[model samples]
Target: MSAAIKRYGLGILAIAVTFIVFVVPLLFMALIAMKDRREANRLEFSWPTNFSLVENFQEVLSARKFMLVTAFINSTILTVVSVAILVILAAMVAWVLQRRRSRWNPTINFLILSGLIIPPAVIPTIWVLQGLGLFKTLTGLIFIEVAFGLSFCVLLFRAFISSIPKELDEAAVIDGCGPIRLFFRVVFPLLKSVIVTVIVVQSVSIFNTFQNPLYFLPGDSNATVQLTLFNFQSQFTTAYNLLFMNILLITIPPLFMYLFFNRQIVAGMTAGAVKG
Candidate 1:
């Protein structure tokens, strides 16, 4: 075969491999969600024998109406507030770090980078929050989400800000603009693309987080969506049909967000690499 034909053949093979590795498992989950408990347990690839999507969903939703509703509300509030704070705070800090040169800048950068490398001390965090009387509250969970997500968001924003022209800041300063005014008016507007990217990525991650909520905010009263998975599982056995339905419900919002914002994520990630 010609070189061009061989290259095209290899590309097709790679695509096929990727589909098998990623798409196939997602397809299986979708199929299982639509199947009966017996069929789901068998884990077959064949079409579902009995389609009871509505019934399964109703069972899961009716498990604990008040608790489920409250959990949904808590999750929404935590994810939205945390992501908003992360984007704004990280963007502002990154803008200054990129614009100003100082010995302290490297130290601050290193501290932020350390968050990604170190494992959180869960018990210590709980102890501190309890002492502050912030334990088992939705607001406290929001703070935890922000703490975990801040480092990565700052890194992303800093990389993007490095590509912005410092001359813009100089001109703004020349126009008698103060630092805060300059950032809010001039720099923040230019960060719209990266903000959208951060929102899409961090919003999904914070919404689906299981560990923090389970350990830090564990209780029926303060449960988030991820913690609600336990409602379908018991010590003896799990209700497979209802569990799958709950999984399906929880998966939809993030899946739709990704599908919608996929283009923006690609553009934001590539923006710095190309421009900087």
Candidate 2:
């Protein structure tokens, strides 16, 4: 009886902790977002007497002539292009690295793993981007995101690919399938779960990313969803209510995505462990 009671108590405690940690802050932000500027600037957790939800949203949306909407489009494009490159390239690289053993395999493996450990150098990256004539462009930002996200995607792909049966590879080869055909048809198709997981995870990260976009891809025209958050602030004054509203709007997409793909992310991550 005591053990069961203790387990239940612990579960309740965890629930309370989660609520305080995540829910409380989000609720507070929502409350503030719905308030007028004067009330929001007070930074109190109290309910607003004058709810300005519609007004705040309207101003935020139309601020600087619908820049937030433009940022959303840019963010979507960047996420799609970057994740596509990361998924295809990372899966292929992981497959090659895992299936083929060679004298330099260990060295290559170390370099790939090191990408996760070593932070990207912004100045040097910018220099290279400028040299390639991709600086301050969506193409450059896409490349930056892909490079930054590649290591983790490769690791996930390698882990999941290891669980796949080698017989499939052999059979495809015997059936006169070329490398590209075998991967696209046989191997890639089987990686749906992990690929979906990667897409969701990377999409959220890239969408919320601010630093890389600010440093490598600067400009009002190139502003991402994250950069729009900064637009509500300035040296002299800040639009707290509009800022919170903007945050709430920008945050909704990723939140909904996680909610939708929660199961797939869990399944994909754990699936790799089943066979390997």
lDDT of 1 at 203: 93
Predictions in order: lDDT: 0.87, 0.93
lDDT string, candidate 2, 85-203, tens digits: 99999999999998998999999889888999999999999999999999999999999999889989998999999999999999999999999999999999999999999999999
Worst 10 residues of 1 by lDDT: 267-276
Instruction: Give the range of the ten consecutive residues with the poorest summed lDDT in model 2.
Output: 267-276
Error of 1 at 93 (Å): 0.6
Instruction: Return the TM-score for each candidate structure.
Output: 0.93, 0.97
> Which candidate comes out best when scored by TM-score?
2
* Predicted structure with the largest lDDT when compared to the true one: 2
Error of 2 at 57 (Å): 0.7
After superposing candidate 1 on the true structure, give the runs of residues whose Cα lies further than 4 Å from its correct spot.
274-276
Could you tell me how far off, in angstroms, the CA of residue 258 lies in candidate 2 after the best superposition? 0.4
lDDT of 1 at 194: 90
TM-score, model 1 to reference: 0.93
